[model samples]
Target chain A: EAGVTQFPSHSVIEKGQTVTLRCDPISGHDNLYWYRRVMGKEIKFLLHFVKESKQDESGMPNNRFLAERTGGTYSTLKVQPAELEDSGVYFCASSQVGLFRPTYGYTFGSGTRLTVV
Target chain B: QQQVKQSPQSLIVQKGGISIINCAYENTAFDYFPWYQQFPGKGPALLIAIRPDVSEKKEGRFTISFNKSAKQFSLHIMDSQPGDSATYFCAASIGGKLIFGQGTELSVKP
Candidate 1:
């Protein structure tokens, strides 16, 4: 089976511009998550979608960032008026129905490297 | 608050030696603990994982020692090799939401 896939592996945008990153999860996976790692920092969770419904969005940094998973298949994270701090690698991961079951580990996409200049 | 805390921002180990990385978590509700390995410019891949119910789990040369009471866990790499060098991240999850620790960059010298 194909693993999670991300679009536009690298993106460069000017400050105050907008950017959207996309992720396609593995087939039959019900849970999708968004995470990003800033320069010299650990990866941080942004939000999670269980199908078409968002399970938790507490990790979203600010109002400028938005994530959606319509139809619970693919997910998109949009950054409006992107700031320099938004420049980083955005990763998307997916897991099967079970919650952290050993049989299925979260499969992550290669990630999108975003640069805000 | 950072739920998970990992130590040794970086480590250099000689080949065939033992490499140990430690992590502590504040949330007792976290039942699933997983370790992820990431190479430069690549997304993290699942290395090994252990549940709070088990004290230790071993897979080949990689072992995870989980301490539920102390809320601490660790990853041990035996007979370390250059191929094992990467950034390792420890994460905990409850209800499917994961909280990750600061990653540990490991370098194995040949």
Candidate 2:
């Protein structure tokens, strides 16, 4: 089985620009999560998806950020008119079903570093 | 308000010593507590985790001590090595959503 994979590894965009980050989770993993960590801060949850349906999005910072998982497969996060504060690494994680599943842990991608200059 | 609080933003320990990181949570509903380790430019990986029902769980050199009454938990790294140096984060999970603490940067010297 392959691990979670993230694209570009790093993304740089000017302020107010738009950037879309992609995460391809492990096959058969039904739970996908998105988190971000700004410089000097701990990683924070952004949202979660269960089989293409959003299970929780309370962590979404604002309306400027949108996440989607189509067909219960790979997921994408789009930041429109991104701001300076949005500069950080966006991490995507995937896990098997069941509460406290994947006893080992959720497999996390290397993450896409988004820098809004 | 921050749901979780971790202490000693940074720590240093000699090789073969012990590295302890502490965390406290405010949400009583949080039943799952886990610690993560992240190297530079990498995503965090689970180190050890414990549920409120158990007071402790050990995995090789890593151990997690949980205190449900105090709503606190800690990670203990025994025989610390240079490879153990990284940023450690304590998190509480409720309903599958994880709330992380501020994080602690641990440096194990050779």
Candidate 3:
């Protein structure tokens, strides 16, 4: 099976511009998650989607960011008026949903490096 | 906010030696702990994981030691090789959401 896929390995935008990052999770994975890592910080959770519905969006930093997962397949994170602080690597991961299953099944994408200047 | 704390921001070890990275967390509700390895230009890959019920779990050359009371865990790489050089992250999970620690960059010289 193919691993999770993310496009535009790198992106650079002005501080007030908008940028959208896309992620294609592994086939049949219903749990999609978004995480971001600042230059010297740990990776932080951004949100989670269970199929087309968002299971959790508490990790979202602010109102400038929006995430959507349509039809439970692909996910997109849009940062409107990207800020200089938003420069970091945005990661996407997918996993199967089950109460008894371990999280080792979680597969991550290479990530999109977003740089706001 | 919950957080996982990892020590030794970076480390360098000679070949055929043992490399260890430690992490501690304040959240006792976290039931799952996993270690991830990430190379440059690549995403993090699951190296190994352990639950609270077990004190330790080992796979191949990777070992995860968990201390329930201490709320701490560590990853030990036995017979460390150059290929083991990468960024290691320790993460704790609750309800399937992960809280990660500051990564440790390990450099194994051959």
Best by lDDT: 3
lDDT of 1 by residue, B1-110 (tens): 44799988999999999999999988788878999999987899989999899999999999999988899999999999999999999999877777888899999999
What TM-score does each prediction get for chain A alone? Answer: 0.97, 0.96, 0.96
Give RMSD (Å) of candidate 2 vs. truth.
Answer: 1.3
Model 3 regions lying over 4 Å from their true place: none
Report the lDDT of model 1 for residue B31. Answer: 74
Q: Which 10-residue window of candidate 2 chain B scores lowest in summed lDDT? A: B1-10
**Top-down DockQ ranking:** 3, 1, 2
Give lDDT tens digits, candidate 1, residues A2-117.
99999889999999999999999999999999999997787889998889898899889999999989888999999999999999999999999765685775889999999999
lDDT of 2 by residue, A1-117 (tens): 888999879999999999999999999889999999888887899999999999999999999999999999999999998999999889999988778543835888999999889
The single-chain TM-score for chain B of candidate 1 is 0.97
The better candidate by lDDT, 2 or 3, is 3
User: What's the residue-level lDDT of B38 in candidate 1?
Assistant: 95
Report the number of clashing residue pairs per model.
Answer: 0, 0, 0
Question: What fraction of correct interface contacts does each candidate retain?
Answer: 0.74, 0.68, 0.79
- Per-residue C-alpha lDDT of model 3 across residues A33-75, encoded as one tens digit per residue: 9999999799999999989999999999999999999889999
User: Which 10-residue window of candidate 2 chain A scores lowest in summed lDDT?
Assistant: A96-105
* DockQ of candidate model 3: 0.77
Model 2, which residues run further than 4 Å from truth? A102-104
lDDT of 3 by residue, B43-96 (tens): 999999999999999999999999999889999999999999999999999888
Docking class for model 1 is medium
